[model samples]
Target: MKSACATKYEQIEEPDMANIVDAVLEHEADDRPAIVGETRTTSYRDLVDLARRLTGGLRQRFRNDEDVCLVVSHPGLEESLALTLAGWSLGHRVAVLPPYLKSRELEYALEQCSPVVTVSDQTPDSAGSVAFRTLLDAPASDLGSSASEAWLETFTSGTTGHSKCVDRRVSRLSDDIEQLASAMGLSADDKVTAMTTALSTTSVLPALLAGSTVVTIPLQTARQFWKAISDTSITVISGTPYAYEFAGRKKPEPGQLKNVRMALTTSARLRPDTARRFMEDTGVSIRNIMCSSESGHIAYNSSTDEELLAASVGKTLPGVTVEVRDDAGKVLPVGQSGRICIKSPYTATGYRNDPDSSAAVFQGDWVVSTDVGYLDAQGFLYLTGRDDHKIHFGAAKLDPQELEDILLSHPAVDDVLVVGEAHVRLGQIPVAQVVTSRETEAAELLAYCREQISATKVPQRIEFVDKITKDFKGQPVRPKYVRFD
Candidate 1:
């Protein structure tokens, strides 16, 4: 199941579509380190050469037009980036296995992607996975195509309760780079570090494609993440709502990250209080970016309008069109929440081998991945929750993210996941699975929730523990409450 080779740019009418990697390589003003790690600093030239070597290595085991599973566990960030781009250089689709993927999940992904070769740290027990050293044996050549012709296959959580592989071309990825770069004004001059799960489109690829240096800490030791930023004079930091909350409360020593200027939060709800607190403590501004892996960024807060600053996900980036539509697919009026549909070259082609799932979301030129939000009169987007995540409490409906955001605002709460539990009297009730800091007590937290949101939105049960479970990519998985199955 290999993807096709390069197609001419004219074949696709994608706006802002161009070879971003070529642009970065040719136009970058700094020859100094574009990627820095604990032991080494990688310059633009080093990245290019390393990618060339890796491409040559991959060519030995697989043809120019094959897909490969990159089971990267390199200690250095520069090495990881080199391997990824090298696969693209050779026209191979790179499917990254999560750093902490269990044996069974890893096995399933390998079978699905059907990589001809596996580029891994240590050869897995699998008979045919290729070794990293093997890829190094071949010689580098000027690969024929630009990055726009290459692609990566990211696995998304499916409606069938399993993971589905989503095919995304480099052109699609460049669309994201454009938005983040335009909205945040990211430049080569900025040194960014993201403390999110690495096997994500936002955390790794977009930062690299933007030509900004990004630092990644493995998911296994996420607690030690601040050290990565503290050591480097990171200019930009991106993470989930949980990450921002944790960092804001902890307020890591200013000396460790004195140079940081921006903190961007995505993939979860953003709290105005949390944003203000983080900025005050760290001397950095918090920016909210609204997007999904299925659909690229539709809007981002421009940091101007206070109300938009308080609730909305900002404005649409350049060359991106966002529409709020009814189930009938009619465009809705401003300030009315509906299905969010986005048209961008950055959105995915479709979920691979899952036409039904693809058809559920892909509508003509736009793809709607169940985000229920609306644009205000000023065009700022306010996201409620995914349509799939909506739950009924008594006769009232609630979005889990709304409850989750409120729970996270508590000073003693470190992390929280709000899930709907089936009830005999009510259809479903919200339950909070909380990971707390030192001071938060379950009963006190319940009182706080009652004070903040409506009683219907309050958690019917508060389960306090040391940790909240997350997927291999570090996205929070709903903690199931089905006691009897």
Candidate 2:
């Protein structure tokens, strides 16, 4: 049986709820590239047709508007995109969970949300979970109800704590899409790359809606990531700071990334060295996007101003507001550092099934962020670090990024994490775990820090390590794996 959405497979102008279906149908007749995978390219016509075919399978099992479809994949670009298109087309709440979630963690998510159906590459150890191929070949039926408004539930990175499930309206997701598409100056000719699952939301979805071709590859390592990009005519790349730094570390041959014109990094602070190295090698400056899973795209360093590029995350996106507020919730003036609160039309409403946590962060219109930063006179945001990321020495608080920046400036320091460990007398002291390029000593680095920053913020203990632990996104896993007895 052909689903109602499939009936409009070739012609859906103004679709219901304005989700990915509309994007798919917008170029249903055009065969131009939609997704550029490692081995294959899926055109808009092909992607939409596949999505429409899958809609029939989805329509058979669940009641539209009432049931939820949980998509669990290693997050292959096409499979998740197809399932998401089908789910959103049918008005089901589609929650896309992270691929890295452990089995028990996935079970916890399943219990919390209780989706009526789960789609994944492998049939998860759950009752209603189905494999991608199974759903693709399942017989179509007309048991589905009429489509209604659909919402998407995506997760926060939870870098500092447990990941919260953010239930966001489709229209709001579209809001950021349009704004970001415009901000990036994306055109039909541009080819963007989705480096990781985290990028599918921020990069993949937006690129499709803007009608830009999206490139996908398995980012196993920095070398693998480079090999994938070397041949593709990828113009736009928006990924984690880890991706850029990791790629820049090997230092590609001159003009290796010549085709790339624009580079964007997520909320993770782009190391100045990494940015400078990428620019020198590729001739494209990496712009830092100050954003979170909770607030969507808040501010982007979209300017060419040297000071702005060096110090801030640029200015707020259109229709977005940023304020620096003190601990007591009073708004701080320009140049004063405090909590960075974001008020946006497209931010997630609240955490699903977690009211207390939602109430703490999602205060009415503005979502209070743990990030601490200040705005310049021109409204550019300069970040110090997260509130929890701060290391306390006696009563004095230490900004890890600030100290890391000072350490990184020294030629000897390669990559470093400034974590807090307890001292016998002092409650918490800053400890610098350094990864060096050349031979360096704790005393030499100590002298460098003493010259750059305040004596109190300098690392009390500097440990020479081969490597520091990093998250999947290439960000340092904080607290430094230091075991304190």
Candidate 3:
């Protein structure tokens, strides 16, 4: 049986695929810097030429259009963009591995994707991986072909479980680039700090496709990130909540971040307190954008309304529909929280080579998310928590996020995670693991919680920890088991 979802991939046109590189070449501001790094800057003309040369290199090595090219490199660089462009230009499937993955994780990704060619700065222990320096000298040649069927595969953050390989059509991605450019109000004169990698479709591709200059900075401490933004005169910035929280630790001097017009955050839930502190420190509101590896830029809160920014993920973007559904897959009414599902042209068709997993999420034109959220009367979405992260209590199921958010509001708390622990009386009880900034007693926190939340929602135990585990994307790692001291 042919799935209706499968038909979405059959509508690609060659001209649509060609738009990737053409967007770079036909940009009106060709002389302006397209890629600026710590030491060197590449003009638009130079970047297009680099991608052309690399595309020729890719074509010489892999003959089959089915060949997948895996890219593993440090974030915030022109090389990553050039390599990705090269792969797309040759009509080959491309997958980008996170830079921070250990050798074992890299090996797992390699075993999963089995790319015939890999372009990286440092060689992975696996075979078929080539250093990026070797590709730079490859002879330049003009080539024209569209990998319309060859989609780009990106893995989920893997915070809750194993990462799923998501396949997005190149044609739809091109459409998203233009739509995003118009929605974000990006222009050629705008300079964005590419804090995320080329793998991040929302952050890197839209800015480049809009002909905006992107400044790439190496992953650095919070202080270094601020310095880079100030030095580069970065007009826009985007990253995870942790990145913004770390930057909020030290307030920028007056006018230090004057050049930065907009700050965007995604990949994890942005705490309201973090958002408020960031604005107070930098004098800029952090725009909380809702997106996933499968669905690109579903919603964004562009208004300066602090209350709205703190509570909702903002209104849905044009051409996208976000709705909440009950357990029966029936759409719920506004204000009724349930599974958050999205219907959009930009949503990925399915996971590559994983039918069981793909069928679990993709339904017709909708991607039914594992996340639990509700929509307001005004069409704003508010996320509650993940369905998988629920705790089974005596007669009730509790959302750990509800408790964690309350704990995080405390002045002494730096970070917190709530998980279910076995209880003889109740089926399970919630336990809180905390990373604190100052001296704080578990009793004190418990007492504070008693004053704020319901008795059933309060944590039975609170353990102080030095750090909380998180994935490469800065999302909290759900603990598999409760630790006993």
Among all candidates shown, the one with the greatest TM-score: 3
Clashes per model (N, Cα, C within 3 A): 4, 0, 0
lDDT per residue for candidate 1 within 1-485, as digits (tens), equals 21221132225576654355564455334566666655567777777777777777766666654445554545445666677777666666776654444453456566555553555667653546766766676887454334545777766541111456667776667667665676687776777765533544554555555677766543233335666677676778877665665555466664766777777777666666766676666666677888765676767777754455657778888768899899899999998878888877667667666667676766666777567777878777877655666555543446677667777888888898888886543546778888887866688989987776555457889988788888999988864322211
Name the runs in model 3 displaced over 4 angstroms: 1-4, 8-18, 72-76, 122-127, 130-137, 143-146, 158-161, 196-198, 218-221, 389-485
Flag regions of model 2 displaced more than 4 Å. 1-19, 98-100, 124-127, 138-148, 158-161, 197-199, 220-224, 389-485
- Model number with the top lDDT: 3
Scored against the true structure, residue 32 in model 2 reaches a CA lDDT of 94
Residue pairs in clash, model 2: none
lDDT against the true structure, each candidate = 0.64, 0.70, 0.72
Of candidate 2, the 10-residue stretch with the lowest lDDT total is 1-10
Residue 293, candidate 2: Cα error in Å is 1.7
Tell me each candidate's TM-score. Answer: 0.72, 0.73, 0.75
Task: Please give, for residues 181-276, the per-residue lDDT of candidate 3 as tens digits.
Answer: 677788887888766545556567777788888887654677788888888888888776667766776777666788988888777566777777
Question: What does the lDDT read for residue 26 in candidate 1?
Answer: 51
The deviation in Å at residue 254 for candidate 3 is 0.9
Rank all candidate structures by their lDDT, best first, as comma-separated numbers.
3, 2, 1
